[model samples]
Target: MTTRHLVDPELVALLDLIPATAPSAENLGQIRAMSPRPPVNLAQSSTLSVSERFIPGPAGAPDVRVLFYRPISAQGPLPALLWIHGGGYIMGSADAEDSLVTSMVSAIGCAAVSVDYRLAPETPYPGPVEDCYAALKWLSTHGDELGIDSKRIAVGGSSAGGGLAAALALLARDRGEVSLLFQLLMAPMIDDRTSTLAEPHPYTGEFIWTRQANRFGWTSLLGQEPGGPDVSPYAAAARAENLEGLPATFINVGSIDLFVDEDVEYARRLMRAGVPVELHVYPGAYHGFRMVASAQVTETSARDQLAALKRAFDRSV
Candidate 1:
């Protein structure tokens, strides 16, 4: 049952670098403490200007913090990306993705907003997603001020962040507040039920992110057992009954990633619902394979993502 033999040879070394420890209430504090933070020299980027702001949060909630990245020399009215960071929805901050957002803004000459939404096990369900919505609303409403084009905005993220991005897309469509150009989901963790499946994928969930970790993360976010009948689509995008009218989508996942089946199924459903979709499944890969920055697969995935974002922006224009 070991999937170690199935992993891309180039990514095998990364297994030792990234521990497979599952998060539990007892060790969650230590995990959060060990999470990477934005570099002190984040503002040193010559091509991009990085700044932080406290924006209005969900009604009755504390203010949401966000990091904004903009190409210093870009022309007016650029496309923007509202990025959510991963960490199983329990850990991770906007600051952790400063470099990733900066690279995108620099490459695409677009504005980027990395949202610092409230984490779960404390905020729970609607709170975390609502914070993202508030950030999206703020970005869309203040587009002119941010030198971004509201019409060309996109939402994206990795892992739990991708799950939120998917949920946010559904929320935006149903609420009729914002029009998203596209959604970039990189190995999105969208199905709480994946952790509860009667027969799990033996090849997937054996690496960086396992079913045990997934269940812990989902339980933390829901404040209850995951895969329950009452799960909300807004909480778990895969629970959504309708994928109609969602924005064009770009989804990419490792063939052996824990969420591969769910991600692929979501893409198929989107296509069936008439949403334009582009999906990629890289072989011999597992969840978070992008952490192996030097690997060819990582490079390919990053290139594909950048190209898709650029294309989405171009079409918007």
Candidate 2:
């Protein structure tokens, strides 16, 4: 129930820019068949070589899709990032984020490996997370062959991708597997219980993620219900009571994002647990606000975020 009068000019403009009708379920197959960013078009750039393959997933589990973004200009042993693309873990592919991964490789000078893990409504909890773990494990195990610096590797994503990264960081640490150098999370959907009446706020009310979408995503992820008993912290990060021993984190969230409070709380817990964290909370911005190209703040956010990540990678490398 966002009142038109209460909306910001940038938000209004971005809303106007959106297509009136998005592809529906019935049109998805047709659209994918005709789309330019399909699996075959995995290498979206002539300047980069996009390697497509199926990486082994969790033990006894199915394989997961993965795409590598290696810049043509970059030489051997490039720094790498295991990126998980965000679409609420429902709809999104590495091809759709080709430009994004390319920008990261060019801007940060790090090779990017984008993971197209299993999505929800088909594969539930531990499915996507396990897929991401397998990808990371494979990345570490084969780091030398890929010409990536194993010690400088990081994990990142926006929204659901961020959620997966956070979970992966915890899982990686628990398993004593890869030593994660950095985690870049942008407006992540880290919590499934955000729609609780006990935590009502202005930020939670107006964002594109309504209470309904949260319910749908969480239900799909959990395969039964959301905000219920016996939810694991790895599945929904906000449920983690102990936040120690995670990797150094860089998080950027809009003040108006629905998960703003949870992000703030997570940062606080991370700090208290002696985990170094850098957090940026932008005002008058909503979740996915960085996607609005016409919005000056959105573009500014992109620049600042990219610069921060580049700095982090430089130091980590």
Candidate 3:
């Protein structure tokens, strides 16, 4: 018998609001060019700090940007999350994820430092990873002003952002530099090995993040052809040889996504290393299926992710 996800009814409205295939470079550039740069706006339920900045990137690149989100009307140190926005390391900007970041502040009631890492095919391998690591290091070093609880900090993101967060965890561990409390990896694209795309994905295969797009994202970021020898663990978190001593993690993926198998495998490795791992897989949902306007799957995915993040925050507190 097939199983059904406990989907939320409101997801339809949210998904319906997204434009199909609108996250591309041309579309994103057009939107940014036409619209005025909005402040870090919050929902009615949230109390958010404003005056966000796009400081010089940690990677020392000119255009590498980072946005800091602090909870307003709150006091003292709060558990923080290093939030990364997903656009296949190609097109997304910090503003593309303000709503989600705002919602994260509301749900977790914690300060979130959202890093706008450099994209691929330009910055390439180690670029985004290094930039994000720099942001994490900066946050930890300035925990007092940022109101962050250094011991309770976590890392999280969606899609490629999720992959980066996972990679960040490993990088922090390998470098023995910083500590991470938890990892929230929602539908991450971690594997560069294209051996698992046996069936055509129900979404984003021919739409937004096609197999070709995945190839480009992986190859461009790695700075060498993907599926080759000497792939960096920082470039593809899935390539990490050991997951021991890593922080606890939560991963959610769609069964119809090309990344499902690799995500599941990554979780397995995390568990194998005695790191606590919680995984959720929704059938019939494809890559970025949650972005499909008005889909039941999207709402369920969002609510589940919210619950997972809130739970993670609750655990640390």
Candidate 4:
């Protein structure tokens, strides 16, 4: 059964433009090579300044590279966001999301540090997430220099980046080193079990990021078959038993996305654990639908995200 008819009329054309290609060792290099890397143009925005720097990574690991975005004319200690990029844990670079971070920094009047974490199949689980932690610690410790409010930091990302954000939030809570104000998870890929479900969602996982791609991504990141018994919660956040004491969360996913069920369940669990959560499910949409920038759903999603961030930043917590 095809879900093509259910797709938003404006987003239908995007399906043809982005063919579903599962990543594997054989074609990973080619796919990555073809992935778009939009240049970070500071000239386009007079109010935002962007700089790249290398911060110390996890113990014994290499230095993690990060991109910092700040409002040029803003004063005082501003709230901060640690932005992560999405590419199913296998690919994607912080530089690729320059426009995204820049937009948020410009609109929210906040500082943002985009972490270029090491990717998987090569670095894997703790490596990628630990790199994010390094960035967060750097951001928190250098508040005086970065002009950021250490107590008001938030973590966010799209897809795999969102997964890392969730994991990082949990890690921050457990480690007691840095605190988070909010977590913005946009269709986060947080469950390895999704790929191994005996009976998968019939209408979802049919476009953009499909079940096959999910399986490949999970396998690469885990360095083992997904759905196995010993997957760590840090690697796949849904594996975590407890969701308490974490910061407030905002999660949004397309109804037809491969991750809708997992994301919704995570939100429900977060609420049950006494954490504040905001969840939105967009209808007639598939994974990565936001790539269709002109689509109404994409516009709505962006607005919702920005509004949620504003509220989080404005709150006293």
Candidate 5:
């Protein structure tokens, strides 16, 4: 267990700027409305292009909004990434991830598509995951028109988005609908059991995302309760009994983040199940530490992610 004093000095400085109040599940709408939307300027902004559109969603559901980012200098169909945004399953939008998505477009040299899936407490369970799956299916089938290499599509996200990416990988494998090239999970929220752990891990869950907040996020997403026997693996990825057929995976988390234990365990299980996996745990960091651009750890994390994505894209080429 770590203490606030043990966290990275840069991260510690950054955390001191924000008020340390936990969000209320019942006031998600208000909180989401108040969330900040920062503008992003890609390093190679002139060479990258972005497009937006609405695609068919799961039957009876609203159309899903997708933002596509591509390199204007590309000579041919590019490998693609279906990016999901993290919001604890109750808040966030494609707009919220615009900066990171564009950065990936420039760094990974892959066409990126951000999915605007519905949030929970309102949409719940299959609703959010299905929306993301629908967007993935649309992208795969429309690869020709989108100038993408259908077979090289990968799924990725941060926090809750990371959880969705993992779940989407499982769904695609089970349904045989879309073939994925990779899965990138950053501080992913995977185990619903996390909130119910008999003895919670100390030194973690104290900054950024907390245990009480986690319970609210999971409960909001699961509709009923989290960690239930009948919970689907597609919703709570850590609940999966078999992790054999998933794609090559890249998992990263801060040693002091609430998700560190779950993410580490999942990576171990994936390796045991004979799946290709890469795991990175940064010490003295907290959840979403990569968001601190000035911190050296943030640059390292970004470079590591780009390296993994480059390897995946190269294999596809």
Candidate 6:
């Protein structure tokens, strides 16, 4: 079926604004130009205060930039969220997501730190993930100074950032470095193999984030061919053989998203491994359907995500 017929009508109009040509190695600049830039006046709440600072990145690597959002009225040491922005691992910056990150702080009354990790093609697998891990470590050790409750920390992101968040959870578990209270994986790009598949579910991958773009993203982030035998779980969480020790997870994906199948399977694996898991699959929604503010699904997605984060924070406390 065509994307228009399969996707939510509101999402269909939004998707129509973008050209559908697949990104390739030769047209990186074209693809970057086509991607969305953060708006000058992001819709934000007055209850939140925003700040930016540089923090220690990976050992020997340069410093990572982070944006902090906190409820102005809240007292010290509140729950915190470490956010990673998504642009298929190759594009996007922390500042691009300031609106959403700040809204999260206002809604949950929690402090949020959005990581400005090094993008791929320049900094691949280990570099991006390590930068995120460093940010997580920084949040943990310096929670007191940052007015965050060390014990109530959650890691989350959208699309490629969600993929990194998932990978970070695994890295934290394996390295015994940080204890994450929860994970919010929103339309995550978690499987390099997603693009390698010989065939996809008939209804998926036709809308925003097509199969061609997915392949480009995975390749860019790996700095090598993706879906090979030697891929690391720290680079792609779906590559992890075990999901037993990860924190409580919230997985949500649009029915028509390219990553829907992988996200659902990961949630199933997390549940089977005895980890607490919450999964939501919104019907008729395509990739980033939540971006259309007027769509009913967008409101539902926001409500569900906020509720999940609140529950995670409350339980941690």
Give the root-mean-square deviation of each candidate in angstroms. 1.1, 3.1, 4.6, 1.2, 2.0, 2.0
Q: Candidate 5, after superposition: displacement of residue 273 in Å?
A: 0.8
Tens-digit lDDT track for model 5 on 14-36? Answer: 78776676777666667776786
What range of 10 consecutive residues in model 1 has the weakest lDDT sum?
A: 36-45
Q: What lDDT does each candidate get?
A: 0.92, 0.78, 0.74, 0.92, 0.90, 0.89
- What is the C-alpha RMSD, rounded to one decimal, of candidate 1? 1.1
- lDDT string for model 3 (66-117, tens) is 6777777778888888888787776576777787887778776788888878
Model 3 alpha-carbon drift over 4 Å, by segment: 1-46, 54-56, 195-207, 292-294
How many pairs collide in each candidate, listed in order? 0, 1, 5, 0, 0, 0
Clashing pairs in 3: 15-293, 15-294, 16-293, 16-294, 125-221
Candidate 2: give the clashing pairs. Answer: 77-147
Poorest lDDT segment (10 consecutive residues) of candidate 2? 19-28
lDDT of 3 at 78: 89
- Residue 271 in candidate 3, Cα distance off native in Å: 0.8
Ranking 2 against 4 by TM-score, winner: 4
Largest lDDT belongs to which candidate? 4
What are the runs in model 1 whose C-alpha is more than 4 Å off? Answer: 39-44
Deviation (Å) of 222 in candidate 2: 0.9
Model 2 lDDT at residue 15: 54
Candidate 2: count the clashes.
1
